[model samples]
Target: MSVMIILIIVSLFVASGFLVAFIWAVKSGQFDDASTPSYRMLWDDATTQKKINKQSSNHKQKSNGN
Candidate 1:
């Protein structure tokens, strides 16, 4: 039907728009650090913070209890 043909054309136009935007983003370095975020998150920042906090709290408790 004519309606189906028009729908297909409209869908293609929208998909191409998205494709162009994706290409533009890639060229602009938007995807440059895509892998780094995944790996960086695997490095536990909380552990280091907790260690520092524990040391500081221990020092404070020792200082105040004396």
Candidate 2:
């Protein structure tokens, strides 16, 4: 039927759009840091908090100086 043909055409277009997006993602280094994300959760939260506090204190000092 004509409706089936139209459905097939629309499906092909949708599939191609997805394929193009996937290809673009691969070329754009989106997957380059695959390992980092998986290991990031294992980092110590205390260390991160300390670093953030230090940076904020530095910023505050600079603002107070100006």
Candidate 3:
């Protein structure tokens, strides 16, 4: 049927679009750091808190001196 042929063409276009997007992601280094993300969450909180504390202490010191 003509409807079936149209459906096949539409499906092929959708499949090719997905393939192009996947290839672009591979070329763009999207998957290059796969392992880092799993480990980052474990250490990010501690490092972020340390940075915040350091900045706050520096601000307090400058305010007290003035």
What's the number of clashes in each of the models?
0, 0, 0
In model 2, what is the error at residue 28, expressed in angstroms? 0.6
Computed on alpha carbons, the lDDT of every model, listed in order, comes to 0.92, 0.92, 0.96
Error of 2 at 66 (Å): 31
Instruction: Indicate the residue-level lDDT of 5 in model 3.
Output: 100
lDDT of 2 by residue, 1-66 (tens): 999999999999999999999999999989888888767776767679989999999999999999
Most lDDT-accurate candidate: 3
lDDT preference between candidates 2 and 3, better one: 3
Worst 10 residues of 1 by lDDT: 38-47
Clashing pairs in 2: none
Residue 44, model 2: lDDT of 64
Clashing pairs in 1: none
* Model 1 residue 31 CA deviation in Å: 1.6
**Model 1 lDDT tens row, 11-57:** 99999999999999999999887688877765668777889999999
Candidate 2 residue spans exceeding 4 A from truth: 44-66
In order of TM-score, best first, we have 3, 1, 2
